[model samples]
Target: MCRHVVPASASRKALLLQALLLISAGMVGTWCVQAITIETVNKASEVMCVRYWIPNEVGGGCNEVRMGNKWDIQVTDRWKAATVWATEGGCGGAHCNTGPPTGVTQFEITVDGGWSNDYYDISALAGFNLGLTVAPTNPTCASQICTSLSTCQGVVPGGPDRTKACKYGSASYVLTFIK
Candidate 1:
């Protein structure tokens, strides 16, 4: 009679591989959720409606499958915004009427999942007019001093403060992600 026995290490490797396969197949295992908050300081006189979306992000706004231009760096999750001010408007959300405009405003959203090891951005675009500051907020962000996008974006995250410009309805801004 002939018999064969599998080594413990070999069995362990097989089990690990199976677990990986299951996770990749979306069959089992859990995903990590990350939260991102945006504080929109409305320095403008008009009560503004803030709108934003994370493109190519693994979330409801983007609703894209796990993907990356460089690799399978699936970093981010289902994102939904919670208005801390009187009105909410973004990606087809509604706006609530408010009597007066508050100089300071806030927006909060939770990303369902993400890779903490990687870096992502939370930014506004060419259309919005809300002064912005990221927190762990940089107090000296304005002083960083950049006359161009390349220079501004080149600054470390949270280093470029566009809140002053955005205060009075500046069309464009450069903001670092507030982790």
Candidate 2:
């Protein structure tokens, strides 16, 4: 009986291992670059709420306020301090359905100038007003809208003294992704 055998080459083994190492190193290097290049829109976010128009009630009120689509003030073209109304049920998935008979849908956008730049703080929202910190954060592209409508904080009303608890002085948006 006769048997045939194939010879193993040492150079071939070394070359195969070198190729694998190069590929692994390249993958690691790509991930590192992507990690450092990723960023978000300066803590900006939106909430969803349904509007309710009741029947025959005074002071912007109605008799039977039924639930409407979720909505709130939305920011668009954050540059030049721009924003507008974003339709309800379109806030993506961050909106919470808080049952029926809802009167207001609150969408809040918080800018992170520093730790102190908050939205809920009444005093801060009323004072030291600053423009937005992002661009094209969002846009519906319909009517030319005013930036005032999209802000949780508005200009201080002129009068003797009237304080509302709707200050947006301490809100910020942050998201995390796993890859």
Candidate 3:
């Protein structure tokens, strides 16, 4: 019988090369970076709403509206701040939608981590009078701001505010993750 043995170093190199090839081919999906989840909380008395342009899974854009209270927004671009338009309004009693853009709040940009984690800057931007605290540590955030949209604080309004809630505020937070 013929004897055959692969050197330890050679075996390691081959494995490393294989791993690199897989990664380059986009086959490896463990530690890839993709999007950031922007979570928000509206502390003001007026209900908050948001309108953003997120690339949908299909191809086009996901033009969505996230009502105030608490929302989790999934975004891809880490540099460009999400174009969010907010307003103050709600359903009086019956099904009501559409809230005028009276309280439009711009957002600041903050980035953390590299190819794994994601952080954002929400200190300030423009046209936003409401206090927006990015990555808040106050306990009020958890209690006041719905941890997830499922149990979010406010209800979806009828008219223009009919979209889902993904707006950030003084109590807004950035929930980082790796894709």
Can you write out model 2's per-residue Cα lDDT over 1-179, one digit (the tens) per residue? 12333346547778668668978778432211111010122111232222212122221111111133112222211212111112222234432322122222222222322342312111122322222222221232111111332452322232213221211222222211111
Write down the TM-score for model 1: 0.31
Report lDDT (CA) for all predictions. Answer: 0.31, 0.24, 0.37
- Model 1 Cα displacement at 1 (Å)? 53
Per-residue CA lDDT of model 1 for 63-167, tens digit only, reads 111111111112133432322222222213432222223432232233332332212232232222233333323333232232233433323234334222111
Taking all chains together, each candidate's TM-score versus the true structure is 0.31, 0.17, 0.40
Please identify model 1 stretches exceeding 4 Å from their true place: 1-30, 56-131, 137-179
Consecutive 10-residue window with the lowest summed lDDT within model 1: 63-72
Best by TM-score: 3
Q: Ranking by lDDT, best first? A: 3, 1, 2
What does candidate 2 score on TM? Answer: 0.17
